[model samples]
Target: MTKHMTRKQLNSRVVDEIDRNLRQAFDDMAQQPVPDRFTDLLAQLKAAEDKKNSGGQQDA
Candidate 1:
């Protein structure tokens, strides 16, 4: 005999499916490579921070 799912059980299943899909999408996106411009900008920012930390002179 087949068992019937209650309304709450159906809702829970739907929510679980949505959560799984969203997590998978995020995981896929996280696997992508960082864009060149973004990496370049981050490197520039780090260099500036390092210069400042080393007491490098600021631009006039």
Candidate 2:
């Protein structure tokens, strides 16, 4: 005899598979440190913010 799955059961299985894959990907990424490129980008952003603030001060 064959068994049939309900719609809820099929939906739950798909959700579980997606959750498992996301967890695995997160775990893999957790092993690495932030890259230098990202760090440099952050530094550049900070410099731009500082320049903006200084310019605003001069304008006031």
Candidate 3:
């Protein structure tokens, strides 16, 4: 950082740095494969919802 930089310039640089770091962190997370536990939980919820829906339709 330059000592002669104006406050606006310094603030802009800080904001840019923060935006870059956040984007990189989120991009890494997005690239990661879904964990087995998360996939299993989603599948269980879907199955439960399907069963509930079928049961409700039968009652009607």
Candidate 4:
């Protein structure tokens, strides 16, 4: 026996598949940890920019 899906049913199936794939992709990404080196570099950049903005202040 052959079963045929209506046009609307086919479209809904496609949309469901797309949504499932996207949710899984996002979940996989959320499980990954950020590298410490990246965070360290960001902190260094912010500090340097802050110092420059403060006219190289060396307040004690």
Task: Give the candidate number with the greatest TM-score.
Answer: 1
Model number with the top lDDT: 1
User: Candidate 4 overall Cα lDDT vs. reference?
Assistant: 0.93
Residue 49 lDDT in model 2?
Answer: 85
> What RMSD does model 1 have?
1.9
**Model 4 regions more than 4 Å off:** 1-3, 57-60
Which portions of model 2 show Cα errors greater than 4 Å?
1-11, 56-60
Model 3 lDDT tens row, 13-53: 99999999999999999999999999999998898789888
Residues 1-60, candidate 4, lDDT per residue (tens digit)? 449998999999999999999999999999999899999999998998899898996655
TM-score of 3: 0.79
Q: Candidates' lDDT values, in order? A: 0.96, 0.89, 0.90, 0.93
Clash pairs of candidate 4?
none
Model 4 TM-score relative to the real fold: 0.65
Candidates ranked by TM-score, best first? 1, 3, 4, 2
Residue 9 lDDT in candidate 2: 88
Q: In candidate 4, residue 41 scores what lDDT?
A: 97
